[model samples]
Target: MNVGEWAGLVAAAGSILGGGGWFVSRATRDAARATAAATEAAARANAAPAQQQASLAVLEATVKRVDEENGSLRGKMSRLEAVLRAFAWTTDRWSQQMHRAGIEPEPPHPLVEEYNRTGV
Candidate 1:
């Protein structure tokens, strides 16, 4: 082939190779980005269950604490009710004694009357 023709052929081959190299480089970069994204997704997937378990543990502990507090409150309420009942019994006895002595006892509070009516 003539030198000019040979040069032209070499130029054409170089252009094609350069274009192919650019495409290959671009594809490699895209593949790297895809791999990084997949790795991040896998890491998140692995962590999710652990996070959920931790949250569940916190919830369970909270519920247990609430149950314990409720039990304590119930005991306190029972004692308070017993004391209130004793007070009511004593008040009734006092009112009866006053009546027997021909003295008028002060009237019970309206709220006390309502509680007595409702038995609540």
Candidate 2:
């Protein structure tokens, strides 16, 4: 071939090779991105069970603490009820003694009367 024809052939070959290289580079980059995404998804899948277990542990601990507090509150309520019973009994006795002595006792509050009636 002549020199000009040779040059043109060289240019055409270079253009084809360059375009193919660009496409190859783009394909490589896309494949790398897909691989990274798959790896990240796999890591998240592996961690999910551990994360759920952690949440379950937290919930169990909270339930145990609440149960303990409930027991403590039940004890406190029992003591309070005993105190109220004693107070009601004392007041009744006092009122009886005052009536026997011909002294008019002050009327009890409505709430106090209600508790005495209900024994609650």
Structure candidate 2, residue pairs in collision: none
Task: State the lDDT of candidate 2 residue by residue for 2-60, as single tens digits.
Answer: 99999999999999999999999999999999999999999999999999999999999
Superposed Cα RMSD, model 2: 2.0
lDDT of candidate 1 over 1-120, digit per residue (tens): 999999999999999999999999999999999999999999999999999999999999999999999999999999999998888878889899999999998889998787668856
Candidate 2 yields a Cα-based lDDT of: 0.95
List per-prediction Cα lDDT, in the order shown: 0.94, 0.95
lDDT value for model 1: 0.94
Q: For model 1, give the 10-residue run with minimal summed lDDT.
A: 111-120
TM for candidate 1 is 0.78
Query: What ranges in model 2 sit over 4 Å off?
Result: 117-120
